[model samples]
Target: MSLRTLAVVGTGLIGTSVALAARRQGVTVYLSDRDESAARTAEDLGAGRAAPPPEPVDLAVVAVPPSLVAPVLAESQARRLALSYTDVASVKSRTEREILATAPDPTRYVGSHPMAGREWSGPRAARAELFRERTWVLTPTRLTSKRAFDRTLDLIALCGAVPRVMGARAHDEAVALTSHAPHLVASLMAARLRDGSAEAAHLAGQGLRDVTRIARGDSRLWSDILESNAAAVAEILTRLQEDLTGVLAALHDLASPGPAVPGGTGPGGGGVVPVPGRHALVDLLDRGIAGVGGLDGAGGGRRGAPGRPEAPAFPVAGGR
Candidate 1:
């Protein structure tokens, strides 16, 4: 079914962006948030009205953080807020499990996570085009009704996102590797600068900035995300730790004295010798290059399905 009305339950970046995108598609959107000011701000940005719908909306988009998804969904369901419900939470498995266990009518719900965001968050950072050409994952279990799933698909199309369906556990594992673990790694790398000397800080380059850019994400929100998907994230981090250990050992060997060579720092001997750890270091560097290159080789830039004609706009619905 075409989505005519949407009730966005959180007025943060994703929620506001969903509302803005839907509003652009002639879908009536109602915005709400625990933070009243945020809802008002989203309304000010022309996203939607900062008021509850007089009746149930076609769907309620729960745009809260991962940890809050289940409780917020439960409360929304209790209020009979919408005909169908979906969440934009980063983690899916835990939330889906909770909904199945707790929601009044889990059949009307489908779990979703949009693989889109800005480094800066909140309603002000939201844009209607934030999700354009991005992959939006839908994790519909056996309980999800066809109508609910179709409504969510309509929502995704309205937002110009390409939809891929995956099981909840698979979605969580994918994001743990792609999103959650990377955020933690970035933040950890950025934290190293906290104790650096002024000269060290001044010598910083764009590579460091690029590597640590996601470190600027909201700490509380990230912590919640990490906690919700702890198992999957921990698995990734464990592998990462093993990789780091190898890199660290290689670095230590490289720093240690090798055989003396004419131009080398080793003790003066006429003969040259192989540099310690050079092979390992070169191998690691090559692998890093290949890993990055493989992404492009695999058509990483492709988002949604190319050449899919835009669906006709939703029928304009009257505002309440």
Candidate 2:
């Protein structure tokens, strides 16, 4: 059955976006937020009504930060706010564990994360088509009731997202590699530009802009995300550090002087010299090109590539 009604517990970007999308599909949405003004803003934007529903909703979406998901879901469940509950927080394992421990009816809850959003946040940044063609991960435990799972899938469908079911631990680890770690890497790279020379800043082009786009996100919220998924994020960052050390060493070698090339004219007619680590530099560049090419057109992984598994289709509720 289609989702007829939903109650969004936090009217931030994701929450408001969900409400807007559901409202577009003729679903009744009730918006609420701890910051009452935010909820009102969403209501004014035509996402939904700011007032509480007269009866329990079909689903309740807790679209808060990872740290708040458990408590908020528990409270909503205790109040009988909805027949089913789901959260749109990035990290899943910690929130799932907390829900199991604290929620009044853990069987009614499912964990979800929409692989969508802009760097800009708040209810004002929301749009009904924000989730179109995007991945919406559903992490359902063995204790999740079939009815609740199906209702969550109906919510995903209404939002125009493809659903993919995974275990909470697996989802956490996957996102840490793809999303969480990348955000930290982007922020660290962007941090270097803060004290850069004016000329350097002026010469910046789309490459730097693209890499640092997500660095403009809310730091407090990102801090909570990093903390919640620290272990998985740390593992990925450690591997990145190892790669960085090798690249730095290669760059140093490339900058060092080497034996002069016979009969070669250098700049200003001086004898030309070869740089050390030419082979290493070339290899690194080649690898970078290959890695980037792999990410293009096929999303992240290359399909049918040797030693790489084909990308899995987004799983629907009962079947795809």
- Top of the candidates by TM-score: 1
Q: Which stretches of model 1 miss by more than 4 angstroms?
A: 262-273, 297-320
Q: Relative to the unseen true structure, what is the C-alpha lDDT of residue 282 in candidate 2, on a scale of 0 to 100? A: 70
Q: Model 2 over residues 1-320: C-alpha lDDT tens digits?
A: 57999999999999999999999999999999999999999999999999888999999999999999999998888789999999999999999888898889999998999988788889999989888867899999778999889999999998888899889999999889778998999999999998999989899999999899999999998999999999999998998788778888888986677655564544566453445565566777887676555544443232345666665553322232
* Candidate 2 Cα errors over 4 Å, as ranges: 257-276, 299-320
lDDT of 1: 0.87
Task: Judge candidate 1 at residue 124 and give its lDDT.
Answer: 99
Estimate the Cα RMSD of every predicted model relative to the unseen true structure. Answer: 8.4, 6.2
Collision count of model 1: 0
Kindly report which residue pairs in candidate 1 clash with one another: none
Lowest-scoring 10 consecutive residues by lDDT in candidate 2?
311-320
At residue 236, what lDDT does model 1 achieve? 85
